[model samples]
Structures are given as C-alpha cells and as structure tokens.
Target: CLEPGTLPEPQLVASFLDLNAPVLARACLLLECAFFVNRCNRGEWPSWMKMNLPLPMQQAEHLTQASSQHIAISISGPAGANSDPID
Candidate 1:
C-alpha cells in the first residue's frame, strides 16, 4: 500500500492504473477534487492547469489506443480546453 502523501513512481502508477482502472479512477476523482480545492484556496494555478487530470473521455481514448501488452500514459486536457493536446 502507498504511504500517505507519497506518490508512487511514475512507472508504478501506470502499472497500477492498468491493473485496476476503476479503483484508480475513483481515487483520482477524490484526489483531483482535493487538489483543486487546495489550489483554489491558495489562489495558485499552474501553467498546465487543465492538464492536471485527464477527463473520463480522454482516459477512455487512451485505454483504447494503448495495447493490452503495454501501457502508455499521457496527461492532457480536453480538446475544447486547449489548442494542443499536450498543453
């Protein structure tokens, strides 16, 4: 189990997500909500604001595109939110 406030390594996070998407999705939703609330209270917006969390549709697309034998992870905002997929 992950210790509090200690993020898993990037590769481990990807592996975990691939193994259990629904659990990761629920955890992500909660974490995103907490992060947003904290950021709002502090009045700080990072340069890549919307890219912080991929929306449900984006996640679905990524899952479909990646092979079952391999997991490719990318974080991007919704198409309508940004001109470039990475931005």
Candidate 2:
C-alpha cells in the first residue's frame, strides 16, 4: 500500500507551478524491480552498484499533469499574458 498524504517535494512542486504543469502527477502504480535484481544479483558483481528505473513512468505522468494544470491556470489566471495553452 502507498503512503497517504505524502506529497511530492517542493522543488518539484515549484517547477510544476512555474510551468503550470499538472501532468506531473502519477497514478502511484509501481511495477516490478526484479528484472534489475536478477541482472545484478550475482556474487561476482560489485556491492556499490545502484539502481535506477529503466523507464520513468512518473516523469511522463508528471508532464501530462503539468500540461493540464498549466492550461487550467492560464484560463483561470489574468488575461494579459501571451498564452497559448489549450483549455
């Protein structure tokens, strides 16, 4: 189960705000990490290795959220700036 009420970091939030991008949100879905584990679990491997997601689903989700949020903000914000966001 995912933790409740755990918001994303402020820097990330600020970036989202600046871009008014809400595609930044994610579905909280987690896939398996076993593929990486299987590749690096050999005893001959070094111990200091680190793991990273082969594909970042969160980033994609965030961008989508950010775009949506940006559009919403543009519509709701003042009507003077050069806005091209889709409503």
Candidate 3:
C-alpha cells in the first residue's frame, strides 16, 4: 500500500500515456499473498475464471471489500490524447 506523503514522480512520458494506458491505482497488498491471477488473452479468460479459488466459495464475498472508506480521486487527462490500450 502507498503511505501518505510518498507519491510517484510528477511527470510522465507522453508516449507511455498515449493510449488508454493502464493505470495502477488503489493498490492494497494483503498480508497473506496466497492469491493471484494471471493475465492472458480474452479468449482464455472464461476458462481461467472458472478455476476454483484457494479459499471456499462462501468466503469469496469478502474479496471485493478491499476498503471500508473512500476518498476523492481526480485525474486530469492530457489536452489532446488519442489511442486505445493494448490490453
């Protein structure tokens, strides 16, 4: 998790932000790193998602509740940006 007062660099490379570049936001690291998902083509997702999780299905409901509080997030896009994300 990102602690207060420790933000990343101020400027970003224009090219890197060209398309709907992926943005890493609200990263929360669970103490127990027992779960992870792989990134693959859209075609492969259906089968991959069907795989059972390490934990029981009944407790999976808790996975989505990553945060108990919310904060304002403001992102200003470039003046003239065009392009779509690769993935």
In order, the Cα lDDT scores of the candidates are: 0.59, 0.48, 0.34
As for lDDT, the candidate ahead, 2 or 3, is 2
Model 2 alpha-carbon drift over 4 Å, by segment: 1-55, 78-87
Question: Best-fitting candidate, measured by TM-score?
Answer: 2
Worst 10 residues of 2 by lDDT: 26-35
Candidate 2 lDDT score relative to the true structure: 0.48
- For 1-87, candidate 2 gives per-residue lDDT tens digits of 323322344575446545633442422211112333344555323233333342478789989999999999888766646677788
TM-score of 3: 0.15
Q: Give the deviation of candidate 1 from the true structure as CA RMSD.
A: 18.9
lDDT of 3 by residue, 6-48 (tens): 2233343223345464454122222111122222232333343
Which scores better on TM-score, 1 or 2? 2
lDDT top scorer: 1
Q: Which stretches of candidate 3 lie over 4 Å from their true place?
A: 13-19, 22-87
Ranked by TM-score, top first: 2, 1, 3
Residue pairs with backbone overlap in model 3:
none
RMSD of 2: 18.6
Taking all chains together, the TM-score of candidate 1 against the true structure is 0.26
